[model samples]
Target chain A: MIDVFLDNGPAYLAGFRMTLALTAVAGVASLVFGTILAALRVAPLRPLRVLATGYVELLRNTPLTLVFFGMVLVAPQFGIIPPIGFWTAIICLTLYTSAFVCEALRSGINSVGVGQAEAARAIGLTFGQSLALVIFPQAVRTVIPPLINVIIALAKNTSVAAGFAVVELVATGRRLGQAIPGEAVTILGGIAILYLLFTIPAGLFATRIEQKVAFAR
Target chain B: MRTRMTRAAALGAVALLALGACASNGGGDGAADVDAGDFPEGSTMARLADAGSIKIGTKFDQPLFGLVGPNGVPEGFDVEIGKLVAGELGIDEGDIEWIETVSSVREDSIANGTVDIIVATYTINDTRKEKVSFAGPYYLAGQSLLTLKTNTDIQGVDDIGGMKICTASGSTPEQNLLENYPDAEVVPFGQYSDCLEPLRNNQVHAISTDNVILAGFAAEHDDLEVRGEQFTEEPYGIGLAKDDTDFRNFINDVLEKIFEDGRWVEAWEATAGTVLPTPEPPTIDRY
Candidate 1:
């Protein structure tokens, strides 16, 4: 088992690097894209709110694997050639996770009392300014916990990328397990450790920031 | 809150460590259960005979080879072969335990006693010999190219230059194809079925897998055809534990009996012959 670890350490590291890069890219993209959707969901216009609501409801209700299969299998009929494994996973991850992230931020926006938005309007701010300036800061504390949860979910969800044949951490671990027989536990455990080593720290940082800027309530 | 979170994290880490310890222990010492009950000693066959049942593993996906039937039972050429082997061991076919062994975990399943044998479309190779012994190269197959029905240019592997070629992940064919066609964009999927969509849509120019598997797919889809002659030979071997030489030899003898009695041909005709022409069975490599 130790031999499996020693032999595949570099491969596992490479896979971990890929996983981290995937998580980073998806995390940032989802945050940006999701924020826009959240803004749309809460906008005064009913059509924008319905459209955002439709997207979030549709994606959140569907399984991620099915979404991936649909994109790869069905997209070709429409002449959209999805990229190979890595980029395919990134696209699916961004699309799926943005829905959840949008919901989180929307709930956070709601948690900021209506009085805050009224105050923004009292200061002669427009709809965008009101969100960008007053309500968003207060909403951050409410969003932190669920946002962190979504981030963790997104990171772990990268495991499904293995189905598409990307050599991410789980797939690397699987290949190592196959190469060095009878080390399924060691290979999988090592992968879990590598994931925790980084993800736990990220979670801790989120918690720290959450505390420092915690809402008075 | 900090203490609770810290304690939870510590608990999780410790639990994971404990699981790892248990598995490593299983790998080292707990794998000797073949010696537990015995009508006679010195051979896995005798032990299995005493145990009165045998667990057989085969692929649960490949159609006409090892797929589960409409009845929710494993029914294919490999499954029938497993049934025959179980019957020879004095175990009734109904009593046989069918385990699904994917390509990558064949060795591990043998080592851990998850299955007494694997009959998946397992290609025998030297790299695998270090971990598990093989018996009875019962089926002869070869790597073949699969292309959309409209393709005319890709008659062989040489035409895959700069083509987007796909194969099942973790398969030797994938390794061979990637090594030979360095310029081809290699796309791999976990299951052979996953590759079909991309091929149908022309997202990938070609699919390469064992002829046996490709034949099954081609039979199912009118718009898909297996093109070219075989590029490489792959002998399908029955995998067993490395130390189980007696059992391996016994399996080889059973395979020989089936071949001699025409049961092998009958089994193939019942399943794969629906799509594939009859081919001579590969001879065994006794170790």
Candidate 2:
């Protein structure tokens, strides 16, 4: 209805850029960090496994809203003072998303048969070598779908960063809707469509990957 | 299995039809009475009263405007206004249900029926009037900066060039800085509460928002203070669905009454005086 964004396109676009950046950073960080935590989770040593387990459980159990609140509230106390919207959302989302990623990858690692590791060891490979050459490759293929799911989830969760003033999609919509009186539904709907433009394709891709993995099995 | 699927479809159809019926045939005469014949037939308030109680949205973090007090009860100026609006409708303040809104959810909360009205510190701007209706210039505020008491480098809005300033999303401060101070960098957080903690730790050079809200930070941390004159004029108002002219008129009338009867002054004094300098009361000048 009312096209307020047309008048304030620059501000909305600025917010959109921040949203995209935050999501990309969180997605990548979660993937890399979670992979390490998953490997640690699947490690044979009890202490290493315990440390990974603790991180997963603690992060998973806490609400992301609280985590974000903590990030804005507590992160600075730790000397991690992000000087711009760019770093605060990325760093906080990285921490929040990594917890879920670790769990997802750990499950993926579990799906990888132990016999592969055993075969690597039998062939005279070291533990790290066995994991890199045998276990990790197999685990990655198995976890692709779920990891994609997490990526989509992380993308959606990036909207929460708007609360911290991260210029993401939802915040953009909020600004537009507030700017226009009679067009909130239209404005918010446009935002939802934008989010779907990103997420629906990701969900479909993940589903397709799952189908392929299932077919392989 | 096919029969079950058909049944589910039928149920969904029924729900849709019910919603359509509610939308079309709803809105009793209460809101129409307030509209002074300016509103179209069947406004949001009439429909809401047909269902009972105005569902107002507000923040749970902004201290004096809208926030959860130490007792974990929602209390603040905006919260009080939400109650008073409902009371003017002859509904009890307790009957006025609250929908918790953050900076990101305020607009959608109204559009989606999550709230029938928004009493958040929502600025009524030309851009905002397109999507939702605003009742009055309920409060007059300005964008300003807050910094740690010990910091000396930044004096006001001007010194923040290339410095990190903390703000929340969907706020005017971010827009003001980028437009006026192109050299300044902004760090956005989800809530106003987030900005101050970072300020306390020196993570940011300054915190920017309405001077009134920054006053809350000043009250909380004796180390913080509002610096410089009020930089930008920000007029706060209540938000309702754009189609809800009946509801909007009723709200405007209530605002007018409060502004004149001195009750509004008492409310302002009881709440805003601690963080803000005692000033002349705001008048309802809704066009």
Candidate 3:
């Protein structure tokens, strides 16, 4: 197993780096977009709420593979070519994952007391100010663990990028396995280990944050 | 309870026997008549002949080579070649079970005894030889490029610098692009068919693989066309268990017979020949 990694260390590292890059970029982007969607879902205007709910439901219900297919294959028909590499993968991952992230944050926002929103309104603060300065700050604490879980899932979902010409971890393992069938098991095990390197740490971080924020309702 | 169990087992055996009989009756009307007495008593040929069935692995997606036909059985040059080999063992085409063997799993299927032989447009190479023996460089293919019919920017390999070229991952063509044309960006997919969508969308500038495979795609789609001569020689071979010298020699002998008696030409003319002109049969490498 060690020999497999040692022999092809550079290739494995390159793949590992791509996965990490994909996860980090998509993770941060989805958080921003998802938070916006969640806010919109709870916004004052019915049109904004309906739009956000429709966007979340449509993307969340669709399969990630189909989303990728649309971006890679169907997008060009509409002249929306995104250069079919890392950026394309980023677009697909962000679009698919932000919906789940939106749901998680919306649930967190709902968990906040209706009294808190009324209290913010009773004051001189407007709706946007209540959401930004008061409600969102409180909602984020409870949603951290779930949001991290979404990021972890996003890390694994990056493997889907393999089929779309983004040579990440799974694609690297497949290529190596094909080149050296004799060492396929070892190579696959090594890939599993590389994935755990990211996921396990994220899991631990989630646990730590959940405990840190363990306040009574 | 024991008597009931025994009766059930007996019924199952009878059903299987009936199915086998029906299969043989429906199979290969043009099956060759080879006498079992002509082969040595313990050879693979005699065993397969006496059993009257053979398991062969081949591609089910490659057009003009081994794509699955409308009737559910695969039809193409590879399937025809497999049928020809089975006929030599006195096995009918229907009795020859066609197992789908993708390029990546060809060696594992042979090593695990999942199939008696593989005729999946398998390429012979020194690395693969370490795991499984090969027979008959039956067809010589070469690495080439496929592009859109109206795409005038790329006429050949020289024009592909810094462009995204798609090929099957873990294939010889992928390796060729990586090693020979460092300037070209290689996008590897699981199967050659998977690259077609990307190529059509203009995500990939060209599809690079074996010339015959490219020709197969070109024949299917009006917008695609094969470009330039072959850059690397890819000798397609028959894959079987390693060190099976007798079986290897037997297959080679069968290939030599087909070449001489015009059956090889007939199989080619019926399948790949529709798209490609008939080339001289490749010389069988006995080694």
Candidate 4:
């Protein structure tokens, strides 16, 4: 096991790094985009709400692999070539993950009391102001755990990029496994451990944040 | 209860008859009349001959080499070669169990004894020889490029510098690009077919792999054409468990027999020869 790591340290590290980069970029982008979509779902404009709802329904219902296929294979026919490697994977993951994130945030937004929205409206606050200030603050606190879960899922979903040409952790493991068939078990176990290193820490951090924001209702 | 038992026995008999018919229909017309008694005692050939069955591994997706035919059995040059070897062991085509061994798992499959032999257009390299012994580079392929018909930019390997070349992951071509052509951007996919869409979409500049495999793809699609002469010599070999000299020699001998008897030419003409002219038979390295 140790020899496996020692021999293929650079490859394992490079793959781990790529996974981290993908997760980090996609995670942050989806959080931002999903929050906006969530806001749109709860907005006063009917068309915006319908559009956001349609996007979430369509994307979240579709398989991630199909989404990747569309982005890599289908999208290019229309001249929407997104540079094929890292960015393409980033776009696919974000598109797929943001929908789940949108639903999670929308649920959190709905969890906020109707009275709070009415109270903000009773004042001079507009829709955007109420969402950004009164509603979003509370919604974010409630949604952190679920939102982190989505991000964690996104991290694992980066494996799909392996098929499309991005040499992420799983692809790296596969390459290493092929190069040294004898050490496949050790290489795969090491990859699993590397994934945990990201996910477990993020889970614990979410827990810490959740406890920190645990206010008496 | 007696009537029901009689009905069940009749159904079982019908099923057995149907299976027998299917088996006879599916068996290819290449079973050799080798005497099992000719092999020395305790040898792999004698053991396999006694058992009257052999498990062969090959690629199911590679078109000219080992594509799965409409009858659900794989039919290609490699598969035909497999049948010839099995026939020498007194095993019929129906008794040869075909296992799909993709590029990456060929070594592992042989090492773990999941396959008696592999004829998956397997490229013989020193790295693989450490894990599994190889026999009869029965065919010699070379690393080449496949591009769109209209594309005039990449004519050969020299034009591939700084271009995106898609190839199967964990394959010799991928390694070749990574090692030899450092300037070329290597895009590795799970299978050669997986690269086709990307190549068609212009995401990859060209597809690079074995010339025969490229020819297989080109034969399937009108738009794609194989470009550039073969850059690297890829000796296609039969993979088996390492250090099994008896089995290796037996397979080599079978290959030599087929080469002389014109059975190899017939197999090639019926499969890969549709798209490629049959070349000189590669020398069997009896190492």
**TM-score per candidate:** 0.70, 0.62, 0.80, 0.77
- What DockQ results do all the predictions give, each relative to the true complex? 0.24, 0.33, 0.35, 0.39
Quote the positional error of residue A20 for candidate 4 in Å. Answer: 2.5
| Runs of candidate 4 exceeding 4 Å displacement | A1-9, B1-61, B71-74, B79-135, B231-234, B237-254, B257-270
The 10 consecutive residues of candidate 3 chain B with the worst lDDT sum are: B22-31
Over A130-163, each residue of candidate 1 has an lDDT whose tens digit, in order, gives: 9998988788678897899899999999988878
Candidate with better lDDT, 2 vs 4: 4
Clashes of 4: 0
The list of candidate 1 runs beyond 4 A from truth reads A1-6, A215-217, B1-62, B65-138, B159-161, B171-184, B229-234, B237-281, B284-287
Query: What interface RMSD does candidate 4 have?
Result: 1.7
Q: Rate the local accuracy (lDDT) of all candidates.
A: 0.83, 0.75, 0.88, 0.89
Residues B197-285, candidate 4, lDDT per residue (tens digit)?
Answer: 89887889899988898889998999999887789898999999999898899899999999999989999999888867578888888
- Please give the range of 10 consecutive residues that has the lowest summed lDDT in model 4 chain B: B26-35
Sorted by TM-score, highest first, which candidate order results? 3, 4, 1, 2
Q: Which candidate, 3 or 4, has the higher DockQ?
A: 4
Better candidate by lDDT, 1 or 2? 1
TM-score of chain A as modeled in candidate 3: 0.97
By DockQ, the best candidate is: 4
Residue A8, model 1: lDDT of 74
Question: What global local distance difference test value does model 1 have?
Answer: 0.83
The 10-residue segment of model 2 chain B with minimum total lDDT is: B28-37
Rank candidates, lDDT, best first: 4, 3, 1, 2
For candidate 4, give the lDDT.
0.89
Candidate 1 residues B95-209, lDDT tens each? 6789999988889999998998999988888999999999979988888888988998788887888888888765667777756778877777887789998877777888888
